[model samples]
Target: MKHIFIVSLALLSLCAVAQQKPNNEVSLDALTTETQFSSDSPDLVEFIWWIPNEFWEASFSQDPSISASEAQEIVSLVEDYTIVIALKGKIGVFGGINYEDVDHIQKEFTVTYNGTDLRLIGEKELNADTRNFISMMKPMISNMLGPMGENMNFFIYDNKKSPINVFEEGYIQFTLGDYETGTELPLGSLLQEKQCSVTKKLHNGKWSYCPYHGVPLTNK
Candidate 1:
């Protein structure tokens, strides 16, 4: 009877261990979501790609305040990729896609906001001519900034109204909105409100953007 009881306990322990799940891996399906926001515009779509802070720091060669081990642990809890899109009537949608496929799309955009200054960076396929598109977007970009002061707002226009095309060779444009120089805000301070920005990329390639001057970095 004692031997049988020991065997049963060992089997239960083994079963529990087998059922336990690992902490670090995230599934692509678990990371995507569609969100709705209160606004006059159409719904937007959002995609998220979460990377371990340690991995991000390692990839960027920047040492953030967090420890590598901790970052690795925390990242496991969140998905690695985030993608967002705008839909009808102030509603938006977002979710995470397969990392492999997400990495393949050939378009890119970057936005940098340091409290006062907001920069927009863009890169598109080389085959597509973006000069006209960039020229027309200036006013929209300016309008998106509104009056900059303590807190700022960001907005994305309707994609259907102004569809952006991606081509073979890409372009990068960075637009820096109005900013105050001697302010206390530091670089890379995350904004409190949902800040607006855009980006696209083709297959693990780098996304390009303009400099603080709002001029396409490719030109310089």
Candidate 2:
């Protein structure tokens, strides 16, 4: 009877431990939707994001309290960040955004097939050009929609949403020809002008650095 009792106690302990473990299957929509924007704020975009455990441990940048196996919620500090990286290198442009218009200033915007919901960001209407661009990016975004993957990165939306950024190297081998030879892509040009903070990957599997800011060109 003692042996049976011991075995039963062991099984109960195991069950309790299993139940205490946090769910690895985090809800993407819930995490992303928590980001928000307000008209009364100083800036139109908000810098909020869900940080993974690896990021903390990789640099050990934070205190010992943050561990590799533990995920951090509600991270808002971002530098040199933009929505262009979410394009998956499909196209080189940022048509749906207007830099001068703070509201249009994209804070890590990613392509999505879902209908445009500006209300989430305190906006009543979206620019037509932006709408069309979002439409074009639907398929590309859908191609990589799901839980976090090996090559996927995350972007915070105006501090109100979270979107996965997929890194598909060489996804588009080449373009047939340049549609506009002389005219530069508006977003591409702005990126060069140091107006936006979209990080570019180097050949060494590392991110580029900003000389002026003297920091790594990446979103935090």
Alpha-carbon runs more than 4 Å astray in model 1: 1-63, 80-220
Can you write out model 2's per-residue Cα lDDT over 93-115, one digit (the tens) per residue? 54232222222324323323122
Query: Which candidate's TM-score is highest?
Result: 2
Worst window of 10 by summed lDDT in candidate 2: 180-189
lDDT of 2: 0.28
Alpha-carbon lDDT, every model: 0.26, 0.28
Error of 2 at 37 (Å): 23
Candidate no. 1 TM-score? 0.17
